[model samples]
Target: MTQQSATQGSTQAQQSTAATDAPLLDVDVRATFQEQFEALAASRGEVTALIDATDTSTFAQLEARTNQLARHFQERGAEVGDFVLISSRIGSLIMHAAIAAWKIGAVPMPVSDKLVQSELDAIVEVGSPALAVDTTDRALSVPRITDLSAADELSADPLPAVVSPQLKSPTSGGSTGRPKLIVSGAVGDPAAIAQLGRVMGVPENGVCLITAALYHNASFSDALAALTLGNTTVLMERFDPETTLVMIEKHRATWVYAVPAMMQRIWKLPDDVKFGYDLSSVETFFHVAAPCPQWLKRAWIDWLGADVIYELYGPTEGQAATALTGAEWLEHPGSVGTPKVGEVSIRDDDGNPVPVGETGEVWLRRGVGEPPSYHYLGAEAESAEDQWETVGDIGRVDEDGYLYLTDRRSDMLLVGGVNVYPAEVEAVSDMHPAVLASCCVGIPDEDLGSVPALIIETADGEVPGDFDGFLTEHLAKVKRPRHIVGTTRQLRDAAGKIRKREIKREFLEPTAQS
Candidate 1:
């Protein structure tokens, strides 16, 4: 957006928001994200800071509103180091709550607004947040604040600068459906965040567009990075493949954060619609949170320039990470790239370093004297002495140091004495054009001990006639799924994460009945 267009729909309280191509946070000033928000307001105050489907906020507006809301939370008993669980539909309130939490030196824990009462209870029990926003419908264990009108009555004047010890506390629950808060070990400093962003391919002070739900790690990471860099970020309330392209074109988005599922959906769009948008503005196209099918990655690389495609792989814990450009990926086809952060290694169950090219647990230890990358609230780290930890991922590194993940140890199936990786099976299932998403889980088999059962979400909710033959050609016999089920029911969440345990349970009932 041009300077004129960005300020058009901004808050009328003060319309002097300056839109510039320059970075917002001054690394030299030594400020937390909270103080940087105010600094941005002083310099880039009138610039558009956040955008949702129905509203846009300038830096000035965000600073003032967050100030008022910070006082609101402080007055309601939230304090430094406390968790402010944020759950709301995407809009001004979401950003307002997050920035407000930061202003008061509290950690903002964003969770899915669509979570049911039981799910919310489980998460709340773990974090035990001092206060919650937009979760008004429940009789929670803590105070639940909903009305923003009262906050409007509070002073918008700046609060005393306070930096949170924990940068953020995003929730994660893979397959097990057990929610846990991942508290970042980094302080709430923009300089550290900016430094990390650069290594992760985040463009500074450019138009950023996000399609995933804000609750996800990647979504909030990009959103906050956009804010820290003074970039105008456009957020979609829900993802629509066609609308994603429209927003990119309309905003002239220079950076986009997408997961493989989202990327696949966009590519599945009619070629005319997919290729119609002016995507030349996109300098970085990012995908993570799930393993991308090689075919899909190739398609995106062919469509977008190889340099524009960026893939990052790591746990949200942040201790271990690997990244690859499309060009690098072309050279190391199935590799997730060498480590750009942390000291990553592959080790056997005995904690001995695995020989290169042999699959084992992927381990990471922080840089010398560095604090832990993250600490989990609900569970202990799967770790060893000497600051080494594993997230239960099974992978191997090539002699060249490129890492290739076979699958999660918990997700791997032992089929007739063979190590069957569900990712390999699912990747093949997703290779079929009709498949939108696929999950492979192990089912009880009298002969093989356990067999792969694939549940796929397709356009017509029916398995294609040629899918069996397609699977036969792409996957080995031991890796093949014995049962293939089709469903119209949504499989993956908005963040492109699938719940394999749920998939297995649901599919198992029908087979048992038959």
Candidate 2:
């Protein structure tokens, strides 16, 4: 057989093998999801699967409750195309409920469980989920999930056949004025899922930690992969550095998936507080919500004493575009490695492929083992033929084919008539031993049109005020920040993307009198 045909046959064999043993739940997408969850519970037995702030759910318990919720929604007025807005904090309840929603063929809109009333209102107003399932009363008037037993009054609609995993609508970042609903879909490609599992080293017996919110795509994939692999998952409702360290020690979580900011916070805990936990159980210390500073990554590697720290590069619309392990990362330094199991390329301004070594938009075409599975809700972000797509990132390929992400084109700063990429300045700022995390932006300046500004979030001993002098030592005067801001809390969104655009509006936008 030719190489192309051989590859095709190989994929077919894998799918055929999976079909024989893999009992997809109902038949359609909903049953497939139900089966995935049920299989995990059956295989894992009483393994502690998820922990919320106040409650814990074992695999069996989670499966039982999620099924009840799924039955409730199925009985309610939910339809395949209808959106199910799940608003809850990070917990087993929310994650399992989302799986149940998927099992019923209803599109699940995962709203951040931590959102205040106003944010929840905005999302609910835009998404308009047919059923609003919230666990907590973050908002006074929202419908909340009380109990599954009570759901018996609802109808028992027979589950639909397997529909493809498609997102009917998506939650926007609100980078612009208002967040709009985006049409999106999820990929059900087994090859891509298998490749992601391999890269994550998701063990059949390990417990995967979901520290990121369920609403975010990265977290969604993390939860799905954990269930698909029949492993236990521990969910963190909200990340508390001390709490996280304790949980790692307490639960003996085998794998952790977190954003760089959270890792920085965990590392910043006093050595006495940080070292008390037993992290030996964590084999896959993976992260991918945002660009991790080399310093932070190095700190984590040293702290974890595990060589399994991995980074995945992909967006909401793009899942598992590429991944790199800690060992490979040290060898390549800044590269996010080659495409995980797909094809990655850099496209220039004109939409043509840029020769290797030149910075351009990073684009991916679903490759041999990675089939195209995601679809956008609307034309705002288009996915075209050949299954190629870009997530607004600028990057380049090295001579060895490793991918180096420079910055997001949207986050680029124009300073003093010169282009200043915030990633560059943030990289320099992060080099400061005292600085834990930082974000840079161009503030309006009459003298230079726009000038670089820095917002620093200190680790334990670091101070934002001290960052300016430290930054001056590492960067040119022009690139130095005109102002420095500070925050003790998490600075990035759920996906670990710094809300720089939002930060600019809150601080720099008003006071940059120029």
| Per-candidate alpha-carbon RMSD to the true structure | 10.7, 6.9
| Clash pairs detected, candidate 1 | 17-46, 17-47
Q: Residues 211-268, candidate 2: write the lDDT tens digits.
A: 8777776676566667656666777776777887777777788888788878877777
**Against the true structure, whose lDDT is highest?**
1
Output the TM-score of candidate 2: 0.82
TM-score against native, each model: 0.92, 0.82
lDDT of each: 0.81, 0.66
For model 1, how big is the CA root-mean-square deviation? 10.7
lDDT of 1 by residue, 1-514 (tens): 1111111232211211111122233334347656788788998888898899778889899888888999999999999999999988755577778878988889889988888889889999999999999744765778888787789899988888888888889987755577788999987667756655665677767888888888887778777777777788888988889999999999899999899999988998888999988999999998888888899899999999999999988788888678889999999888788767766667666666656677887777665466788999998877776577778888887766788878998998999999999999888888888999998988888888888889999988999999999999988999888889999888888899897777767877577445
